[model samples]
Target: MEVYLIRHTQVAVDKSICYGQSDVPLAETFARDALALEQKLKQQINDLHSAKILSSPALRCKQLAEYLGQEIEYHPDLLELNFGQWEMQAWKDLPPEEVNPWMEDFVHLRPPGGENFVELQARTARVFDALPQLEQSPVVIIAHAGVIRSMICKAIGLPLSNAFQIEIDYGSVSKLVCRWGLWNVKFLNL
Candidate 1:
């Protein structure tokens, strides 16, 4: 099975805002970005037209999934990591005391009323576990950078602590292949 993990396009939020799991809107360049992404996918995947599309329920992801003109299935597991009270808060304005602990141990530390990376990893693992049963061919998942990075980590057998090492830029696509329970990364941040 081949999986195409796509991150959402630029969001409408301010640059420093922490908007995990928030239903943010896409930027004005959505149409242009979506078109470029669609063309890129067509060029990379031969059977893109027949691929199954799954997306997070967040508007940022749904907009692109809809724009792609495919029958998309929404999955809550695909949502970005919940930032809880930190939602919409400017990252630079957050107190160092409040943010430092999480920065020191992000994989295990949960924000005030938010989930940690371990929880995000668990949910994303479930999504990957179900993929083989859901489809035999290519599968495209439109989701957040966190979710895409989590998938990449799982596919490549990297530790959750190294999640940040895999950069999933907005509107970027990463490809993974699974064969008989073994996983391999086809490409990253394409």
Candidate 2:
């Protein structure tokens, strides 16, 4: 399978804050970024006749995926990390005395009333396993940075603890091609 893992465009939020799974709106800059994203995808795929599009159910992702002007599957598993009660709060604003411990061990740390990275990996794995054969075409997934990061870690043999070291930027594209038991990372954090 040739998976084009995509991170959704920027949201309208403070850059210094954490906005995980908070149902935030997309930034106004998205209109321009969407056009560029469309063009970028065209450059890579060249022809969309054989491409399959899937996306996170998050409103921001759905809104950006509309640029494809084609049918898209909404998969709940592709969502960003669930921050629970921490949603929408500036990381720095939160009591570091309380938040630092969790941030230090991000992969295993579950937010208050939320799931940990282990749970996230399981959910994303479901979506990852469903990826179809890509030799016949390409598969495009519009999801969160964390989703893309986790997939990359799984495909490239990186430990979950090191997943965050892979900086998947918003509106960026990451690619992996699977053949037999091996997955070739075509691009990372693109």
Candidate 3:
């Protein structure tokens, strides 16, 4: 099985804002970025026309998936980590006291009214577990950074605590291959 993970294009929100699962708009450069990604993806993946395309239900991801002109299967499980009360708030503006605990142990610490990194990994894992059963190879999943990171972690047998070490930039693509029940990362942040 060949899996391609694509992060959504840049969001319209400011850099300091935390908009996880907040349904934000795509940036003005979406069309240009999408076109470039499409071209690059075509060059990288053979049989692109027959590959199965999946995406998060979030508008940011949906926009890019649609722009790619593929029939997209939207999955809510592919959404970014739920930031809860931090959604749409600037990270710098968040209460340091409230943020400290999560920062100290993000993998296990649930933010105030939010899910922990472990929860995010579980949902992403579920989505990945179903991929091999799908009737397609070179499966493309368009989703958020967190979702892609979690998938990479799961693929490489890396602990969720080290997820931040994998950089999933907006509009970037990562590839993975599964064979005989073992996973191998092809490349990342392409």
Candidate 4:
């Protein structure tokens, strides 16, 4: 089975805003970005309609998935890391007492009322574990950068703390192939 992980297009929020699991608007260049991504995928997939589409329930991902295919499965587990009290707040404005510790060990530290990277990996893994069961060749998953990084970690046995090393940009696509119960990465951030 082949998996194509796609991050949503650029958002309209400020760069400093901590937005995770928040329904933010896409940038004004959404149409252009989405069209370019679609054309890129077409080179690999003969028919987008034949693939199994899965996406985060967030509006940004939903819109991209809808533009790709009509039959999409929205999963909450595909959401980005929850920021809790930090949601929609400027990262620089966050209390250093709270943000400093998390910055040191984001994998285990929970942000006030939200979960950590470990939690996000666990949930996304549950959904990823079922991908091989689907009767599809190329499985397209539209989600956030964090979710994409989590999947990469799960695929390669990489530690969650090092997930940031894998740069998944907005509207980027990464490919992975699962064979004999083992995952192999083909390319990333394409």
What lDDT score goes with residue 93 in model 2? Answer: 82
Candidate 2 lDDT tens digits, 1-190: 6778888888888887877787889999998988777777877887764688889989999998777748888999999899887788888787776588777887888878777777888899998876753344488899998888888888887888898888888888888988886888988655
Instruction: Indicate which candidate wins on TM-score.
Output: 4
TM-score of 4: 0.98
The lDDT of model 1 is 0.89
Question: Which 10-residue window in model 4 sums to the lowest lDDT?
Answer: 39-48
Give a tens-digit lDDT track for model 3, residues 102-176.
888889987678899999989988889998899888899999988998998888889988999889998999999
- Give the lDDT of residue 22 in candidate 3: 92
What candidate 1 gets wrong by more than 4 Å, as runs, is none
Alpha-carbon local distance difference test for all models? 0.89, 0.82, 0.89, 0.95
> Distance (Å) between predicted and true CA of 104, model 3?
1.7
Q: Extract clashing residue pairs from model 4.
A: none
- Put down candidate 1 lDDT per residue, 11-48, tens digits, no spaces: 88898899999888899998899998999899878877
Estimate candidate 1's RMSD in Å. 1.1
Ranking by TM-score: 4, 3, 1, 2
Q: How many Å off is the CA of 103 in candidate 4?
A: 1.0
Give the clash count for each candidate: 0, 0, 0, 0
TM-score of 3: 0.97
